[model samples]
Target: MKIQNAIEAKLSEAFDVRILQVENESHKHGVPPNSETHFKVTLVSPDFEGQMKVRRHQSIYKVLAEELAGEVHALAMHLYTPAEWDAKGQAAPESPNCMGGSKKDPAMNAQGDH
Candidate 1:
């Protein structure tokens, strides 16, 4: 299964999911074309009602342990209970642009003049 679909399915099976969005953010990062190294996930579920944020994140990480250890380079998660989702107007924050090795450092840009 595609990584995004796999995440959705797993979370659905694991919880009473109200909303789930798995975004492949590889293109925003500096990975090769068609890479699935980075991701953003937003999950809303009743299972998260009494859980702490850390606990919620742990659950997801546990479910995706294999992918985390191997294929996935970064996993950005925004987990919420149904009420929290509603409070936030049902929107997850967008992922930031890549600033890893592939992104040029402004300080280093003047190197060519030296």
Candidate 2:
């Protein structure tokens, strides 16, 4: 909850948002129960209107660098302008189920592995 709040506060402060969702999707993944390590952020803002996809992701990554570096294992981002978000019915794609790894590796932080 702390990480989620921090992310929301930082992004809301930095951008002018029409709609924002910071979801802790750790449960949908295969991480330990209640772990705040996976997330999905849907941000609808005018700031993304003219930005490229890579740039949008980079901006978010930079803002959540601290969380991503330690607390967060993966971040699924959905960035859009208000128009784009409205066009899509204000919905983001659901995350897929996680398939656990056969061999455990501490540094293997795979988004797909959850």
Candidate 3:
């Protein structure tokens, strides 16, 4: 939770945060147990009001540069203005299941071996 805590603190200090959720989703991926490599952040802030979607993402990336450059492998961000959150019923989209790093049986890849 160390990384998650740092992200929450930094974002709160950088923006007028109305709503924020930081979820550690590394377990959902093919990493070791209790890993902190993946995260999903949902943030609603007035600071995003005039910003474009790319800009909002950029701001977050900039704020969490250290984390991104290090242990953090993936960041799924759902950023919105207060009005946009309200319009969307104040919910972020779900993260998709992880599809990488899983091992498969060699027989499964045998082609035309029947």
Q: For this target, which candidate reaches the highest lDDT against the unseen true structure? A: 3
TM accuracy, model 2 = 0.84
After TM-score superposition, what is the CA distance of residue 54 in candidate 1 from its true location, in Å?
Answer: 0.6
Compared with the true structure, all predictions reach lDDT values of 0.83, 0.84, 0.87
Worst 10 residues of 1 by lDDT: 105-114
Tens digit of lDDT per residue, candidate 1, span 45-66? 9999889999999999999888
Which residue pairs show backbone clashes in model 2?
Answer: none
The per-residue C-alpha lDDT of model 1 at residue 58 equals: 97
For model 3, residues 4-89, the per-residue Cα lDDT tens digits are 99999999999899999999998776667788889999999999988999999999999999999998989999999999999999
For candidate 3, report its TM-score. Answer: 0.88
Quote each prediction's TM-score.
Answer: 0.87, 0.84, 0.88
Question: Candidate 2 overall Cα lDDT vs. reference?
Answer: 0.84
Where is model 1 more than 4 Å wrong at Cα? 105-114
lDDT of 2 by residue, 41-95 (tens): 9999999988999999999988888888998988989999988998999898887
Error of 1 at 17 (Å): 0.6
Of 1 and 3, the candidate ranking higher by lDDT: 3
99 in model 3: Cα distance from truth in Å?
Answer: 1.2
